[model samples]
Target: MSNNNNFRLPYFLLLLILLSSSDFLPSVFAKSQNPITDSEIKKKKSECYADIDSGLWGGHCKSSSIAKENCALKCLSPACYELIYESDPLEEGEKDYIRGQEYKYCMYKLSVGESLEGVRGSFDY
Candidate 1:
């Protein structure tokens, strides 16, 4: 009985140690708030536009209009909108239209060999 009790004591101590130290372990699910790089932002913008185009043209959905609207809402970057047009009182549709135009211009600048960082910085706001 004493030998069995000795074995159980070590197991209980190990379990307690593991439980107490669990909070100190590195978390795999942690997210960083670091700003994204210019290239990464550009890649995301391209992907967003592709999704919008696909949603507009793809016939998988019941209504093409609804698909396009949903894709636009999902893909449009609010940060981009805020950065380009801060505190404007435009309606949602108008804002979206302006954002689209600005995005296209940014893409054109990128095609002409301008870095995304430079294009972003060139904007007035």
Candidate 2:
């Protein structure tokens, strides 16, 4: 029990740190006339299409054109979000899909503004 408590301590502290630090979190939105350029979107979509040509999803998701299109669309919409969500520490299980969910929310906000986090000046999340 003590050992378990010790393990939980760091996780608890990390959670606390993340929750309390404003700088650590991404911005909900930022003002931009156009956050995503059409050319940029096209480029991403093309890159995503190219990527699907050789990945595991290609072999597995190819038969289902809808699934393939959805996967590619996800990759292109928010490239970073898709990559991060796909590679999040938490795998697909229980509440592990939070990163993906947050990414979706982030995308929605990004569609409206350029900066996800209005952190005065910084590009990282």
Top candidate when judged by TM-score against the true structure: 2
Worst 10 residues of 2 by lDDT: 88-97
Instruction: List RMSD in Å for every model shown.
Output: 11.1, 15.4
Best by lDDT: 2
Off by over 4 Å in 1: 1-34, 56-125
Itemize residue pairs with steric clashes in candidate 2: 27-116, 27-117
TM-score of structure candidate 1: 0.31
Give lDDT: candidate 2, residue 95: 52
Clashing pairs for model 1 are none
- What lDDT tens digits, residue by residue, belong to model 1 across residues 63-111? 4544444444345545444544445423434435545556555555444
Question: What's the true lDDT of residue 79 in model 1?
Answer: 42
Candidate 2 structure quality by residue, lDDT tens digits, 2-83: 9999999999999989877786554433254455566776787678777887784557546555556657656765454454
